[model samples]
Structures are given as C-alpha cells and as structure tokens.
Target: MTSPTVSVKRVSECFVKPQHDHSQDAKQPIYLTPFDLPFLNLNYSQKGLLFAKPPPSENQHFSITTFLNNLRNSLSATLTHFYPLAARLATRKQQNPPSYVIYIDPENSPGVKFIHATVDVSVSDILTSTYVPSVVHSFFDLNGAICHDGHTLPLLSIQVTELTDGIFIGGSVNHVLADGTSFWLFMSSWSQIFKSNVNENACFVSRTPIFKRWVLEQHDPITSLPFSYPDEFIERYERPQHLKERFFHFTTASVSKLKTKANTECNTEKISSLQAVSALLWRCVTRARHQPLNSETICKLVVSNRGRANPPMSEDYFGNPIGSVSATTTVEELMAHGLGCAALRIHEAVRSHDDKAVKTQVARWYRNPVVYKMSGLLPPNITHIGSSPRFDMYGCEFGLGKAVAARSGMMNKGDGKVTMYPGREGGGSMDVEVCLLPEYMMDLECDEEFISALIEE
Candidate 1:
C-alpha cells in the first residue's frame, strides 16, 4: 500500500540578506581549511526540520503571518553575526591554484534563500505514520539547482512549511559552511530571536559566532599536499537511492539495559550509551547483511573535536571541528565477540581522540592538506554514523512552544548509514534513524534480538 503524499505549495521565495553591511572584508577570500576541503565537492547540505504546534489561545497574536515576519526579520538580524553563511564559494576557473575559496562578496553574492510553503497534510498525520513520511523531505528546499555547484549555491536555504496543526521550519545549510554543532548554534540563535519577537536588544550576546577563519590555522607555514578534486570523488561517494529509511526509538530504560549488558561483557571498561547503541546497530546490521565470515566490517564513528582541541576550542566556535574514527573487525569476530567487544572497540576508538591526539591530527592535516580517501569510497561492510543524541533539537522554540520532533532530510540514506537524534522528552532516550537496502532491512525487521531492544512508542 502506498503512503499518503502531502501536497506542498510554494507561496513565496526570496533572498534574505544580512541586515548589516560587511563590505570591508568583501574582497578577502576565506581560504578553506584542510578540514573543509573534503566537503568542497560534496554538494549535499545538512537539512533539519523543527515541528511546533499552533498557538494555544485564539487571543494570541501569533498567527502564521506574524510568525513568518518575525522569522524573516530575526534571520536577517542573526546573519550579521554569521555573515559567512550569506556568502558564496569561489572556485578556481582553470588556472587558479588554490582550488576554491569562500568569497564574502556582499555586492554580488546571493544571500541565504528564504522560502514560504504550505503543506496540506496535518502534523499529526505525519507523526502517527508508521513509515518515514515523504512530506519530511518536501519540507526542505533540496533543489539540485540550488546545491549543484559550490560556486552557485547559497550557503543556507530555509523553508517555512505551515500545516493544519503545526508548522515545520526546514533548514538546508551547505556542508562546507558548517558542521552539525555550528548548524544547531545558528538554529538556536534564530529561535531565540524569533521568540523575542525580533527585538534587537533581546538577542543573546554571549551566543555570537566567531567569524575569524584563522583560529583553526597553524602558526607555521605548512607544506601543500596533493588532494583529489570533487569530480574525482563524486561517483565514489554518491549514495545509492534504492534503500529505505526507518526510525527506531529507544527509551532511556532500554538504553540503560543495553549499556549494562555491554559493560558486563567487557569487565575492564564501561562504554557510553552512544557506543553501546552503535555496537548494537553495527552487530545487527552486519548480521542482517549476511556477509562472509572472513569479510572485514567497519563502523565509521563521527567524533566531535570541540573538547579535544589542544586548548579546547570554544563550544561556540563555528565550522567543522569533527573527525571520523572507525572500529574494524572481521565479521566472524564481530558476531562471535558479542556486543561488549564491539562496544569496547568503539569506546576505545573514541577515547583515543583526546586533546593531544586531535591536535596532532589537525597539524598533520595542515602540513599535508588533503581529503581522506576513505570518504568517497565506502566499500561493502562499511557504515558511516553522523550526528549525536546530545544536541537539544527538541528544545528549540519560536514563540509557538518547543518542537515536537526533529529529523534529518539531507543525511546520507544509503545502506549502512545512520543518524541519531535526541528524543522529544529528552532524558537519555534516543531516536535512531537507519537506512539499509531492502533485503537487509527485511532481515533487521525479523531479527529477534533487534526487535527486543526497540522500545515501541
């Protein structure tokens, strides 16, 4: 049976420029850090949707018109601090040597695009659906035309979709411009401004973004290393579209149970909830795939380096401060060692990314600046996990109360890809979204161990 499709009507589209002018640094190009280069060829954006129910009282002045006006105004104000987001990427035309640079050409560059849309489907219809709804994809502006080339695309695009019961504010930010933390920081700030009714004085000063690009730069001159261009990596990393996405909710109690089980197996060290959950999923997904016993399987864990910087970079410091750490084991070992072994491997891989290690890695990349070859080539038996359950996505409010739920529209949705989100109620509960080929998904659904771990909502 086919799931119902929501009809989305675009009401308006316009570019929202920064309220303040930043022409002084217009000609200067923000050079891409070695960390930012891997994302250059990847036109994919980080898409998030925040859903909020309508105002409670009829006497409330918060109508859709007022809400949108406030959002537009607030976004304009917020962009002043996040000016780089309003700019575009400048790529090398033939003879240009440095590859690509972000040009803050306020005069000619197109600012972030703002779109107003309406969906006929109600919010409850979506929340109650068994499968991941297609409407969630429509909420964001995922147009290929807008994100085809790093040079032409706006660094950010936002769509405000109104429904019968609530509203969905969808955001698509260029991956090169920011990481998950930076993205959420911008979002939280936007919500603050909207909640304050666009009052300039009410804007939180402490949350201001630092736009200095050199903070991540090394003091000494670094030797240039050879790197693959976006064209060379496109086909290798392109996600397969023949997979299905499903959301599995795990309550705090279930998470504790998994953690306890994993710890009991590994007598020396205790693994985190994140590691435990990843281990469980990794084991289940790998088994579902039914690969050869000797085949090597890898779980690519995305680790945030915010706290691991030598001096510890400020939590508010924007840009990508993230790196991938992987736990590798043979299929036979992974299946035989139980969840504790996999969890321990994951825990250690993450623990190894301490301050000194993270700093050393950054410096090494600086001297030999190049995108990792592992990024584009995900051979069979490999999975890349992005996002974290720590982010307070459900806490974001915009005058209409807190968000009921959140989901990623632009995350990689191919086989062995996973993204995690904090549960709506937000204790230690988690929402794990998994993507897999139909056969593997079918196997996963039938696995008794996997089914037993899930906490049915």
Candidate 2:
C-alpha cells in the first residue's frame, strides 16, 4: 500500500480566562455562558476517507497562512461569532481551541493520520471545477475532534506537489452548535473574512435569537425530560451500519397547500411550512421501524431555543442557541392522522413549551446525567429543518473558487440518523437533505407511490 502525506501537530495551549456577564442593562440581551452550562456534553465524530482535488491557479498559488490569518482576524472582530453559544458549547476558559498541524512527520503516522492519495486528477482541473471536488470529499467525514468541544473550523492545507493543483480544505463540526445552515453561514463568512474585504453582503448579525429558554418556560411551565429510562425506549434498536445521503425537494405550492390544510386541521390561523414537513417525515421514520402506528410509540423532536431562554439572548451572538424543545408521539398518532393533526400536535408541543421548562429539565438532567443513558429515547431517525446560511447571502469566495454546493455532511451519532433543512429559492417552499441509513432511504425510494404523495402537486 502507498504511504500517506500530510500531518497535524498541536503547537501550544493557552489558559483562557472566563468572561462573566455583569451587565445589568435591561436593554442588552442576557446571554448564558456555554462554558459553565450543563447539558452541553455530547460526542460527535465520523470518518470517511475519500478522494478529490483543490482549485486551479494559472499564475498564482493560494496562500494558506493568509487565509488562516484572515480567519483569525474575522474571529477577533466577531468575537461573539467565535464565542457565540451555538458555535461553542463551552465558555471562555472552557472553550476548545481549533487544532493546527503541519506536515512535520508524515512518514511516522502513515495512512491513519495522513490522507492516502490515489487518483491521477490534475490540480488545475480540480480547482477550476464549479466546486473544488477535494473540499466536497472532505465534507463526507466529520473531523470534529480538531476542536475543543464539538465546534467546527475550516480545515485547509497547501503543499507543492508534482501534480500542480493538489490541495485540500476539510474539517468536522459538531451537530449541536450549528446545523447545516449555520455551518454554511460560518463558512461563507470565513471565506469573506479570508479575503480581507468583508462585504456587508456576507454577514448575519441578528439582534437576538429566534427562540429563548425563558420564553419557553413561560409557555410550558409543566415540562418533563423527554426520556423515561435508558433501557425503556432506547436499547431496543440496533445501530445502522451504512450511512447514505439524499436530497428531497418539495414545491412551494405543495407546502402552501399543506399549510392551509394543516392550519385548518389545527384550528389555527397559521402553520409553519416546517411543521407540515415534520409530520410527513415523522410518519416515514416510524414506518421504517416497522412499528405499529400508535401514539404510544414515542419519537423525540428537537427545536432550537436561541431566543427562548432567560432574558432573551442577542441575535448578534453567532455560536450556539440553547436547543431545548423535545416532542414525542407514537407512530400510530402520526400514521393515522392527517398533516394538520400532526402539525397541530407538533406545534403545540413546541410552541407551548418555553425556556423555564428547558432550564428546569436541564437542571434535572445535569443532576442525573441523561445524555449517556437517554440517547436511545431519541428516535432512530432525527430531523432538523428551517435554518440555512446561504439566505444570509454571504458569498463563500475563498481565493481559489466559491463553493458551488454546500450542505451538511453525513452525521452518524447514536442509533438515529439526521436530516437537514435548508432554504430553497422561491418564496413558498423549502428543501431538505436527508442523512439516513442507505437501507432506510432505499425502502422509502422504492415506494414510488408513497414518495410521490410526499411531493406537492
């Protein structure tokens, strides 16, 4: 077997001081500290070794340090972006540092640490492609371990090769901090930041998060942790072996029609487009399990608590929003019901619940530590939708070439798989990219009639 090239080394570790919020300004958003917060512990990792090439350079070479320096400066200016809750689970002192390595001892680690190159593709051809095939290949595996917690950072490497355009940009991120939408937003910003001409066209500076924990508590004063016992609902299923990715496109017209139907069924004025899709996906996942359709068979739904928590956080912070909503329903409840019924139930469960419930539940979980035990209560199929960074219009222009297509990479956490919701053009509809078991998706795909029904006419 051929040996690999490329190596990573940790240069230094710094003692980061903790920053506490003492601001009593009622106008300023109260932000929770990710460092000291409980319920932030989760493990995210995946490995996929694929092949691709970097962008081409006719007369000039791409500078790696320049890009890194730009990224640093961007972080410095947007300190909240780097230290935001969604991006970093831990606070200042607890924050994880991005790993930086060089090819000092490539021959030592062999293929395990270094990428095994096999393919005769030229460098220029690779870079010139609408999207760098190399970067696309890198997205398949999540190298989240490079960060302190499970936060993500852009990974890049440049070295002169006999083959001219040989380069790679890759890294892994935790699923918690940012969904695919957040990832793209950060990437696009990072690219602009690298160029040193950060145009206002490429940044999302929100005044506050959409959902907060405190707001949620006020709505759902009575809340319970979604899990009952570790073995009760979690240990029954086997983990999936093969992971596959597929895209599902829904028309705006179809979603609008569903929205009307959902709103009517729920006896409400409005129903979110995502709530409608969630209903369909919930049923499909349940069917994959071959479980009898019933409300008793529970599945968990996650909702972002960005502005839902106490004191309402500033939308300007870029890290992670406290995620605090979990909804459970049986396969039967979803299967036997129409989209409206499902939407109403899902909406009620999420909307009625608030941050106090999340805070209370978080407090309980910390006392008992439910993540390790309750992962199984989590459905074998998980879905997250309605957040895409591209809408912010941050152009992802690195010196090489802009990203042609960027979506969340495959996420293999516990027993369940994940599906990401991203914005699609047109005022009325949304797009979804599902990261599920190959077998599960195949089963859905084979059912042509069922799949067709899912599409809006």
Candidate 3:
C-alpha cells in the first residue's frame, strides 16, 4: 500500500474556565489519597473520539465557526460543575521528599487547555488502518507528559481536531484527578450540556460526583513520595518496545461464546466475559511468542477498587480507586491446561482480590512508595490490562453527531498493554486495543485459532 499525502497542523488554542463565579473558594487544595498516589509514575490519561458530520441541509446551523463555538461554550458550561478540572497542581515539600497537591488558586486562577487543530486525513483513513496511525497520537495535547508534571502543566487539556469530513475530540487528564470512570463521566456531562441546550445550572452528569478525597486509615494528608527527585518518575517514560497497536473487535456473540466455552471447560467457576477474553488472549499471545515451555509468563489486570474496597467507595467518588491482580505461571502450565485453566487463574486472582487484598497492596505502597516505571515493572512476557468495556464511551455526543470510533494517546503504550471499550454496536460487544511487538503481532494475526474467534468488522 502506497502512502497518501497527509498533514496535521495546529489551528488554535485557548483556556476554558468555569462559567460561574469560582473565586469564592479559589485557593482550596485537595490532597491526593493512597488510591491516587502511585499514578505519579504514569502519563496523563489521553483518550479521543471521532464523529462524522451530517450534511449542511440536515444541520443548517453548522459551520466551522459554529462547531467550535458550540463545543467551547458547552465545555465551559460543563466545567462550572466540575471546577476542579480547571485547577492546577503545585509541589509541596514534605519533610525531605517532594509531594504533589492539587488546588485552584486566586493568583494562578483556573482554566483547562482547549486546543483546536485540522488534519487533511479522512475518518476512513483512520478506521481502515491496520494499526492506530502514530498521527492519531498528535490529535491530543501533552504528548509524553507524566501525571506528576501537572504542577507545571494544565491539570486537564482537550484537543478538538477537525478532520476532512469529520471531527476528532481528544483529551488528556491527570490520572490523579480522574480514572477511566471519572474521565467518561466528565465527557458525558460535557456532551449532555451540549445537546440539552437548556438552562445550565451546573449538575448535568448522570451521577453526582463525590469530590471528597479518600485517605487511607492512619495516613497523613500531606504525604510525600519516596523519590529523591520528581524526575525519577520521568525516567520511566522510555518508549515501550512495541511498534504495532491493533484494535480487535469481539462481537457480542463471540464474547458470549468465549464466556460459555470457558465456563463449560471449568465447571467449578463461572468466568466472566473479561476473564474469558483475557484467557483467550493470554493463551494466544503466549503461544504466539513461542517462549520456552519453562519460561514464566504473567497476566496482570487492573481492577476498580471503587467496589472491591473494604467498605467500598461510592460509584460517584471521583478519584482513582484502582488496584491490580496478576496470574503467574509457566508457559507449559498455561498452554497444556487450555483456556479454562488460564481463565480460572485470572478469575481466581480477580475474585480473591477482595478488600483485604486491596488494603494490603495500598499498605505496601505506603511502606515502599514505589511508583510503576512504565517500561520496566512488568516482565517482557506479560499481558497488562487497563480500562474497561463497561464505560459509556459512545454516549459522548456533542450535538454535531455521535462518535463512530475511539482512539487513545501516547500514554500507556508497551507490548501487551491493552485497553478495553464497549463496541460501537453495543449489545455487550467489546473492542480490545492491543499493543504488541511487530513480529509478535504478526504471529498473533496468523494464529488461526485466534483469528477464527474474531468477528469480521
């Protein structure tokens, strides 16, 4: 396939603050919790959506200027209710080490970065590509930023890119402020305000967000990171060795089949769709890698601590309530026993990661205060899962049109790093975004069993 002429250039950029009077409590500082601290080592969470515009006859009020004005106005109105997003972070030296604290100050004011750009490429050019084009990465702001860098950068930045016949909306959020759940919540609220066009008095999100931050029992509020310097976390930003990122769409029926097969093979445990798909992927990737039978392989899944914690945080609690669980075994044990065995291992790890387990991990983090180095931490033969298929990704409509596809930023990239989203067609469907080494991705593509299980998109 020969390449075509493609170019991307920034058109405009500005800061958007809350529409209401935010000067009342402009200097309030919200301390991060144990649930949020480890994310210091990670990059800002960047996610985007692409939407097609209806014909001019269909939407007589539409224009390049009108579209930008609508989005800018709606985002400002939406920020009134979520004012924390417009704030910034500043470093606080606690004891000898440095700590981060988020606050909206009268001196610095409050605002979120909004960037508008145009690309000559069409939407089809993006969706039809074998892997996510590296250009999709530029559709967002804060290219290689770490969450800890929020002190010098905007706490949140949104980029709205105009495509040839469509539009791309991408955003980057400091993971310390909002996890995947909260990010979508903000997006949906912004969309709702844009569509309603009604009197906005704040409060439009489906669920009311609980802004009160969580603190581990007996932990100090102004806790400092164990690192000697903030740059220690930045060192982890080495580009993940993987060069290929593929989006695998698993139809609703195919997911059901995978789930059924896993449960049938393992009568003792009724595995879920996630566990089932993970099992299939783990086996396929391990087999494709052709690692020695005695080699060790690990499958890690990031679970929401919002529900699994001791008392369980509210679904509306708007901070990072995340924990992880991993299944470790030799390649021989995984492949010889089949999908059922692999799934059960994952299921059991997820099931056993109860409140006690969650607390234990938090406690350990508090003790050592070690942040995850992106390219290091996990083993080479590993599958690390993030995000979820339950998020209302497609519901984010901004009046111009609903979304047709989704893409993420340069963050969280590496071999076997996967993010899951509900399919655009709905009905319990799932889309798995996989990043892998070129050769391994080729092998996985050629794996007949893996390819046969997928639904042709």
What is the number of backbone collisions in each predicted candidate, taken in the order shown? 0, 41, 0
* Residue ranges of candidate 1 with Cα displaced over 4 Å: 1-5, 23-28, 55-61, 92-109, 145-148, 214-238, 363-377
List of clashing residue pairs for candidate 3: none
TM-score of 3: 0.94
User: Tens digits of per-residue lDDT for model 1 on 1-457?
Assistant: 2245547899998999777777676435665555566555454555565565655674265577777888888998888777778887665433345332333344445788899998777767767776567667788875443232546767788998887667888888877568888888898888777676666565553487754453444453222234235554333345566677788899998888889889999885469998999999999999999999999999988877878876777778777667889999999999998889999999999988897777677677766665444345456798778888998676568776777778667344567888899887777999988888888989999987788888543
lDDT of 2 by residue, 1-457 (tens): 1112322222221211112221233212223322112222333323211222344444345454454444444433332233332123222221133211111111111111112222334444443442223233333332323222332332211111122233333434443334333444555555555566443343333332232222233333222223333223222223344555555666767667767777888788756877766666665655665665543544345555545666655544333444434456666666777767777777777786576765676565444533332243345544433343124422544554533233433233332344433333446455555545656666666655347545656
lDDT of 3 by residue, 1-457 (tens): 1144455799899999877766555446767777777777788999989998776577566687877887888888887777788877766655544444433332454589999899877888888998888778888999788887777788789999988778999999999889999899889888988887735564365666777766678877655675555666555576664568999999999998888888889885479999999988988888888999999999999888888876878888877888888999999999889788899999999999998888788788788876667767546799888899999999998875669998898787887888898899999899999888898899999997688779543
Best by lDDT: 3
Q: For each candidate, what is the lDDT?
A: 0.73, 0.41, 0.81
Candidate with the larger lDDT of 1 and 3: 3
State residue 424's C-alpha deviation in candidate 1, in Å. Answer: 0.7
Best by TM-score: 3
**Cα lDDT, model 3, residue 431:** 94
